[model samples]
Target: MTTDRQISDQRVALVTGGTSGIGLAIAQRLRDDGLRVAVLDLDREEARAVANDAAFLFVGADLSRRADCRAAVDAVTGAFGRLDVLVNNAGFQHIDPIVDFPEDTWDAMLHVMLTAPFLLSKYAWAHLAASGQGRIVNVASIHAQVASPFKSAYISAKHGLIGLTRTQALEGADAGLTANAICPAYVRTPLVTRQIADQARTRGISEADVEQQVMLEPAAIKRLLDPVDVAALASYVVSPAAWGMTGAVLDLDLGWTAR
Candidate 1:
């Protein structure tokens, strides 16, 4: 779906984790589409570049902290005077068996992926409604729909994030606000590259085997998704054509969930 108003003039988007990987690709795509962009990331160097060079405002901070999340929202609102789109994309994965998972890491993952989205949305709620085109696209994973072993915390958080997306969509529908989740099976990125190595070690498999057997084996595509594929879906979700959509989970999981 699309909208009549050009994305550039409607309002602003605040994207957490916009410095790299899928986040960076989304930020660049939105900027190219003419929307004002504000990025929240922990990378100081990249933040400086984006702040100075891109069609975006950059705030360098750790999003796992509620205060930091609020600060990033403040920066977005401060820059654009209103927020039209909020993309909750900051996430990391730690692969460890449930019996061996570190307590602190588990806490951090839940806070960053799940809690941060809730806090950012709450902080940006009024501005979104006011925009009359409020949109939220959560970056969930295929694991949100199904699970694998040794990913209890990450899987749980993604599942809960989808639930949050549904609830927000229901509550915001009457007010012209829409919320949805994008679930991608596997996208090639630094994080997934790391996961490959870690999975190899954990499963006593070679990296090639992990890629073939564990990751791509489940997909009909048999190749990692392009970051742009996910970004395009996200851009559409927040557009005016998407006004009627809410409480939806859009999955681009390479048919993994088809099974």
Candidate 2:
């Protein structure tokens, strides 16, 4: 457990889309590392429970809306007094073939995954600039570097996020804030569970086959990533040791691209 002094001495981290899944893991990991943690999410109850008895604040809001993003950042900075780490990890899979894809869904995906990061970074930039040890870790996917069929919107959003991560890292260099993107292969999350079912229906294959043929085929490990693994990487990137690692995409992709 983090003592009061430890909390005061440690940096403050804002983990977006952190109510559950990978974001939840990242928030908990940082809290364990003695950082004051604030989670931005739509799930008020879940967020509170995740950080219960810890130095955590749950800011309930949707990040896809620009105003909501700004308000969330302000709330976090207000409560913590400074912003040290920003993890933009709130997003979902919206799989569809472009011809029949819903425009509304596409818009939602882009806004949530891409635009929201930009807004949160915008709102947090000044505070981060002042901190001199600020960090931003974007949860971009392996799709940020590679692509698959029937995942147009999701892929595009992840790619755009990589661009955001790079540009922000460069801009923050002189100020000592480091920004980097984590490109992970398929993680075993509820979000990916939904993707499995969707892939089953779309490919007219069993969900089991979706695992064997789709998700695992590209990875050298042939297994789903654990949320903790991704969280640990995010934790490291925000540490002082990662100061020189800005504008980089840290791949936890099980050597998927190596092949």
Candidate 3:
């Protein structure tokens, strides 16, 4: 356990999408782990509320915009003075076949899920390297590895995120920085909850059927994963104990890929 004095000198971490779901859980867990935590989200009021409740530094930025991404990083560094860890956990879902998928939706999804991480990583590179044990954890999904129908944008963004993770890992190696991605199966979050309905409509099934037949059908474990499940793994990934774990794509898939 880190002593109080040590925690006073603790590193700072930034979590994107930290207003809710897996991102929120990871931010809380990192705070519990003695790090100074900053949360970046699109909703300013919600971000402020959560930050106040958790005693965290919060910034709101629509990650789909390049200027917003840059400003978010600047806000974190300005508030915390340095950034030691980054968790790219902001994303959303859109259920539609490729033909029906909106072009604007595709562009927005890529911008937020894929391009935002790239830009944030680019901007935070120097401060992270200065930390001397910098860590970057990309909250990818099992969709990054295997694809289901009607999720082209999400799957594409996640797959690209893994590629970004690898590149960051390689570039950060000499600087004592590390980057890794956690590929989880369906997690219980507002995002996934909303997906249940969208998926049901998309597949012409009832909402109840969507969870069992569609979401968990591929999983060996027939249960939705709590946000804390991902948070716990994230805590480990960003810790000093995981220094050798760069360039890795970790699976929290509940055996979905085993088949």
lDDT values for all models: 0.88, 0.89, 0.93
Q: Relative to the unseen true structure, what is the C-alpha lDDT of residue 128 in candidate 1, on a scale of 0 to 100? A: 91
> Tens-digit lDDT track for model 1 on 5-66?
55435578888888788888888888877788888888588567865677568888787788
Best TM-score among the predictions, by candidate number: 3
Name the lDDT of candidate 1. 0.88
| Each prediction's TM-score versus the true structure | 0.92, 0.92, 0.94
Query: What residue runs in model 2 are displaced by over 4 Å at the alpha carbon?
Result: 1-6, 51-55, 197-207
Worst ten-residue run, lDDT, model 1? 1-10
Worst 10 residues of 3 by lDDT: 1-10
Model 2 lDDT tens row, 65-111: 88999999889888778888999999987666899899999999999
Which pairs in model 1 have colliding backbones? 2-241, 8-34
Residue pairs in clash, model 3:
none
